[model samples]
Target chain A: MTEEGQSEIFQKMWSRKGFRAELRAASAIAIKQWKVELSYPLSVLWFIIMPFIWFIPYLIAGTALTGSSESIHLQDLTGISDWLSYIAIGTAFTGLALSLLWGSGFALRREQNVGTLETLMTTPMNRETLVWGSTLHNLQHGGLGVILQLGASVLIFGVSLNVWGILPALAIIGLSIIAMQGVIFAVVCIVLTAKQGWMIVEFLSSILMLVAPMTYPIAVLPPILQYVSVASPLTWTVEGFRGFLMYGLAYEGVITAVIALIILDVIFVIVGTLLFRATERLVRQRGALSQF
Target chain B: MTETIQEPSTKSVESDMAYLTDFKPRIMDWSAARVFATKNLKIAIRYPANFLVWGVLPILWFAPFILMATAIAGPSTSTHFTNISGFDDFVQFSVIGWFVFMYLDNSIWGIGNNFRWEQFSGTLEPLFTAPVPRISILLGAAFSDSIQGTLQAIIMLIFAMFLFGVEYAITAIFPTVLILLIMVFALYGFGFMVAGLILVFKDPSVLTQLIAESTYMLSPIQYPVQALPKSVQAIAYVIPTTIGIITVREIAINGTMSLPAFVQSIGALGFLALIFWGLGMLSFKWAEKWTKERGHMGGF
Candidate 1:
């Protein structure tokens, strides 16, 4: 095709000229994922139950250490007296962080394993549609999983949460989710380029969990490590989520976290898209795109 | 022409199995197990990555908790931990659990996954058909995993001693070993049970993961069993590791084992191991027959 024709096509597909097709492409990918995942009903159930699995370690730790969830010393460190509720909220949010870390990248890899990656890559669809679809699929499962995890933790374990803070917490979480999308795109770029295995996934997830106070309160980390935590969007998300929903801290305190998350969102979108696009172009040039 | 092409492979396999079956063992059947143990050790040495991660990842897993405990209690640490655990050090308390947790993980998840890994690599069937007693292969696998895990555990223990200032006692080693032998025997049975289930179900990844997480809760790996609810502690008591861990912790911290507790735990561990190993053998036999009837042994 001529250069002019290529420009016109790109504009049409990405810009307002071809918005409808882009939406349709994304929706189709999401539907395909939903169908494929739901076929493995056991796997779906496992994911839904995953947060409960994640919670047990900390729950046991709290019980074993203090013989109760409330820790006066921990409260001095983190401003939360009830460790159970705090951990419940933290685990709920960490699910989002982990799903974003693992889900987006694995979607592409899973396709390659099933012999659909080549077709998906070569199809006449906007590239953004794939990212959008992956995000949609992860959020569908991850969001529902978090809600159920938190709900069960509350009902069964009696984790006391400030129910009224739901809307404000969700808005802050929205910013965090957008930031995570960028972060996941960058991760997918590495996956596509390096062809590393699950250990790399483990390394990445572990690093993110370490930097973020997802389970452990960030206050407990040394000042240097606490400073480093700011590098991850999850740190902001966890702080904001806890401050709003669990601690019932004033919204003013959480505003700082919200602002920090939005800044991360912007940086991640810019850097992540560039990194992803660069990796995509390199793979196309090298024709490694066809190989898993 | 077809018979000529197929005859050699059929004869070769028959001869191999016949050789394995014909070999007579002395009263001590240690030589057969030695053969497998050596094979397992070679594999561990050659592709140490699978085994090395067990050593490395536990330190990484344990580090955060240690840091957190230090942060929470600071210089003096949790009085509750010292009072309940009989040790004033929270850092040592959690690290002890982490170390025990690593050993249990190596036995249960590591050895159990060996079954799944063999299937995925298309080696399970041939191994099963080998004329050697199937028990030898499992015994060898369990032994190798434990040896590899022991190396990791030592490294972790040293790291914990240095990093957390844990009091290392030479005298505790003898008793710790005594506890570990019984503990490992029971864990091998648990591993065999998992391997048997995977043979039947073909996918116990989720089930194993659940067991892994639940075991952390039920085993008192990170917390004392007494701290849990009475009902939960009752459940925890049934798990062999829970008893083994409590016994070892007592020995390690206080330099003495509770005699009655040790005896009770050892007896329980022996009974559980025998029951689980028996069930594992039966399950394998049933699964082998079922798969042969269906011709799905080779179809992972």
Candidate 2:
């Protein structure tokens, strides 16, 4: 290209609100994360492999507790003798939820640990874009993991599928992720400020796994836990996915869930953004961006 | 900071003799292990809340299974489970499985990731030059991990029994404790292997996570091994936790601990520990050599 033409392209790229520049920036951050991750090949292999293996506990628990492929209580609770499918769906969403919780939640902490957080923050690019890039990378990997595991589960344990229901299920999961991001933004802010928050991550991961009926019905929990479980957006996400893919809820029920999810998304995003901004301002005021 | 015999300028005659005597690595050095173990415990105690949480929060991992068991059979009795697996109290069965797994989980993860911590702190190279036997370092780390893990496992077991209204007998507890010690031996061997891997490969938290999850799945941590598919069962047997968990749960759930089975499992665990420990030592040495050659010991 001529110098004039190149300059024009560069100017357009430099302009704010330009889709091309935003895309390139996000892509760069994603690629950077991938390269850093791939630098440790053993971890890369595990990242690709562990997401599927994460379900073994639920599967083992289901089989061992019920002692068969069929469960009378599971049948009574969800009206399905196909406990394997029920468990698979729960496990799949749980992995996705995990992606949101750890994958995105700790992205900034990772950058900080690598000594790159301050550098990224000082760049001309927006910080949220970096977060979005990291989150999408995690989500993409996580979503693919759930899909691959779901396929294997269908073949190995014989989970029933309406392949067509995947679109709607994906839609519901997509909406749920938006809601999750709001909550995660708050978590990310706190993690960025806290000291070596790995314990916090583990605590959240285990707590979320237990609180949400990812593999079992929420009704099984104590009365107090039941209320707490229902309050999680993932409860609705898993329930909606189960209803859509497993039990086939009516259209009205699906619409009601979608609306509820939308409301949650708005509330979470607003509160989350506010919390993050407050933390960010405090961090800047104290000149602590480079400290952590 | 003690000098080797080769460094005559820095080595006094008495120190040289001490170094020479320890250099052969024929005699075990309990002191070295104690030092490293104390150092590790001190580092851990730096963040007491974090240390405490790791012991307590693992109980949360057990919560879902208990909740699920309650969902399946209403927390009272499991008729189908009894018919097939010879146990009615599924909560007791699951609690025992997860409880035993705690030792394996803590040992494997703690020992493996200890290398990463050393790397991150920029001290792995000095550690390599320490005159103490490498195995002692592994044992020292494993020693502290076992303390925390064993405490947590007991806490989890008690919490589980109380929550599920399950009861344990002295008969079951005695044999289960024995089995747990054997399992810890085997797990340390595996931990050494992983630590060796981390020593060379650098921080592989994802790999450790994978190993932990795979261990949980294949070991019948929340279920009976019989529930796994035939192929998975064959694979599961290769992991020492599978046998250990099954044996431990058999004691708790049946309330009739079998001596022969317990003794046999202990033997199997010892065999695994021997193989893994040997391999782990060799791997750590190899990884140390690899890192020193590459000058990447501090390259996390």
Candidate 3:
């Protein structure tokens, strides 16, 4: 209430003890979410099946149009002769990207719907703590789903994966998830301020799919979109991922992709964090946290 | 002091009993439907971003199919696709398919999720308690979804026409509209069935996506049914949208179909529409009764 009291509270919030408390809070939130999700086993089953659901139409249409599994043009564009593997990998990654994007992007909205956002905001935990917890939950959930989905694809569709590429692919996935958290943080900022923020998330998801070469080579995109894709961390992740797993490209070949993703990770994370904190503070001052 | 309550006279009690027995509930209430429809329309229009997103989303969805098709075939056309589909313009074929797919998507997300969403928002129980026919609300939601889907599809179609240089036959518009109307009803039946499933299950997204994606793969959305395997094609024909989309393509895109085939397609779709609508209504009524008896209507 007093000036000195307020200053002390701020100092305490920034202390090392406060950071540990935030970490614990984030872990608790994530575990709570997992408990809620695990209670719905059917929903979990559907989540695993969803990647296949989305991929089938693309495979069917591609095969029908090309009259076979192999595409000469696709080979020419991406240096991969197997269209099945290309599409399977892309679909699997898209599934992961969408899960993370929608998961963390709507994390705050979900809390609000459950009537907990206002209650949680009253605590001493950092706003980023809540976001981080949701993002961490999504990362694990999505990562597991991708593994199962890809495994099923390989078994059912006869698609092959480079066994040795697993470690590097996981590393790239780790980097991409971190980079994507930045995007989700910015989305959370919008969610805090707007009623139709999910619409923006949907729009962004589509834009990401369009730009990230999810189903086709980047070379197929127009020059402008190609430039945009090059700048996106997701594009680099997908490129680096496919480079190792699909094309058997070595570490040396994918160094540029690795470097690009690292730079993008730093940029997006910093910008996303600053923007989210600013937006969170603005919404609090405007007394709009509970409006929705 | 203890309060004393007086009992009503026998005559008054008889009159109250008569009040309950005298009134008959209608099978469908058009006035309530108008209210529901108007409310849904107002709610939708209040958020213009929904419309913007709806308009743009189809194009965004269509991009992958187009890009992948181009990557597989060629930029302008694919001879293999043309051979089977009887049309070289994948863009036009895909655009038309995407238009139909939009209605399917809307019906699932909109009409299918209608009751489930109401339950989530804590309004379904109140709505059920009201003295209105349930079918009226379903119809109202269906009407709203149709209006929104049609507008969104038109926007997407116009964009595709200009962006991809797709052209349609002017004379085929009448047939296309007729087939579309039939397809819409069949889809309405599908949506109503999904709505019932959601009512009983109380899990909307997974169920909706399951039905949507299954139908999408089964039906000839972006490709001809001929392109599918023989066994799969047989199954595809049984799907309501399959005949409707194939017939529309024949009339609109390929511009040729024998008179017998045309008649067969129409008759088959008409039969499917009846079957789906009848089954959907029955299932929904059964689900409502089942949930109500179990005291699960307000449990969401």
Candidate 4:
């Protein structure tokens, strides 16, 4: 494009050219991310394969503990005796959390790594557009992971799913991904300041694994930890996903999950945007945007 | 002067030849290993946050398994597990398993990724060209990982015992120590080859992740090999950690092992230690030659 056209575009973007301009910028970043990722074919395979890598050990443990697929104790705790499906589906949902945490969390750091942070910051595109773009990229990869994991579970363990449950499950997953954006944004701020962003992710991922009911129900956690679990968007997502798939959870419970997730989504997005913008400004002022 | 030179010629020439023949660079530089290990460790120590995370990450990582097992069966013991593996307490079983798994993880990721880090930092070429033996560099990494992994593993194990109410046979400490020593040697050997493979593929995460994950699944870390299908168990035995976990657990958690089983476990680990270490050295040497020939050592 000509310099005149570029300046025109920037002028329009600066004037708050509505959601379309922001969406365009975000999609451009997403496309670029995909292009870079697709260059490494093996990494794409690993991305899809990772969920199964995590799921198998839990499967073996469950089978060994109960000596079968059914567990009466589990039934008492979660009203489900099929531990296989419970763990498999829960593990699949964790892909969303991992993608947001690892992918979007390091989005800015990644730009810094590639020597593009300065150019990116100079652009008139809203800073949150970068986050949305990375999040979109991660969601696609995470979604692929979920699909492969479910397919593998069905084939290997004969896990049955309710056909009607797919839509609600997808909805819950989408909301959970959005809710996790605030956490990812907060993590991005840490990434800007901390020398090793991975340590923070390591701590967060561990906490999520414990509290999210991925391998077990929240009832098994201590009373204090249970509150943490209750507050996590992941816990609600898993519960709702499992409820529709196997537990036959009530309609009221589904509504509650949707409402809770929607509230979390709105709060997280707003807070995440503000936090990211402020951090961006601070890093720019401190001349630390490209330090890492 | 001519008369003196005639008299000294035979002895002087013989001594000069001997000196030339004797001059050679040291094959394995222990000093280089020490330097490299110290440097790597100093860098690690500077990052206190990572150390803190590593110290506590294991408990958080393994809690889900223990909790899941408890949720399925009562917290006391699994009758089926005891029947299959002669261990009833899943918490102790998995805690020990995860502890051992950490060493394996450290060796593979630590040594393998060290080379990648070197490449990324634009030092791999210079380091390779240095006078120090290449294997010493990997050995240094192995030593650093061993030291760091050991401290973290001990702390994590202690915390796990208190948090989950896990108990082990204090009497079994001696045997467990011996088994762990052998396991470490075998793991470092495995790490050597993994480092070599990472160099060849130029992709560390995918290959290492595949190996680590596959090993976790094939090994009887979380479940008994007996619980696995016969064919799967056959494949599981190929992984050193499977036998290591079974042997350590047999002695530590189950209280004792049959003499034959004990002998078999020790013998297998010793054999693996030699085989893997030898293979590791050969693979690394070959990879070095291959990478240099292709001029890919400096290409990240």
- lDDT of every predicted structure (CA atoms): 0.75, 0.76, 0.83, 0.83
Per-residue lDDT tens digits for candidate 3, residues B1-300, read 999899899999999899788868999999988898888899889977777668878898778788888887778688888898888888888888887778878888888677876887899999998878888999898988899888988888888888788887777888788888888888888788888888898876766777777878887878888877798888887778788777887788766668898888888988998998999999999989999999998676
Q: Give the local distance difference test score of model 3.
A: 0.83
Across A94-129, the per-residue lDDT of candidate 4 in tens digits comes to 776788788888888889988998899787777878
lDDT of 2 at B187: 81
Output the worst ten-in-a-row residue range by lDDT, candidate 1 chain B.
B67-76
Off by over 4 Å in 1: A1-20, A67-69, A247-249, A290-292, B1-37, B49-52, B64-76
Candidate rank order under DockQ: 4, 3, 2, 1
DockQ agreement of candidate 4 with the native complex: 0.71
Winner on lDDT between 2 and 3 is 3
Error of 2 at A120 (Å): 2.2
* Cα RMSD for candidates in order: 4.9, 4.3, 5.3, 5.8
Steric clash pairs (candidate 2): none
Q: Score the docking of each candidate (DockQ).
A: 0.45, 0.61, 0.62, 0.71
In DockQ terms, which candidate is top? 4
Better of 1 and 4 by lDDT: 4
Better of 2 and 4 by DockQ: 4
Interface RMSD of 4: 1.2
Per residue, candidate 3 scores C-alpha lDDT tens digits across A1-292 of: 9999999988876563566797888888889989988888777878878878888888888877887788888888877778888888877888778878888888898888888999988777778889998888887788887888789878998989887888888899988877888898989988889955877777787888898977888787879988988888889888778777865645455788888888999999999999998998998899888887
TM-score of 4: 0.91
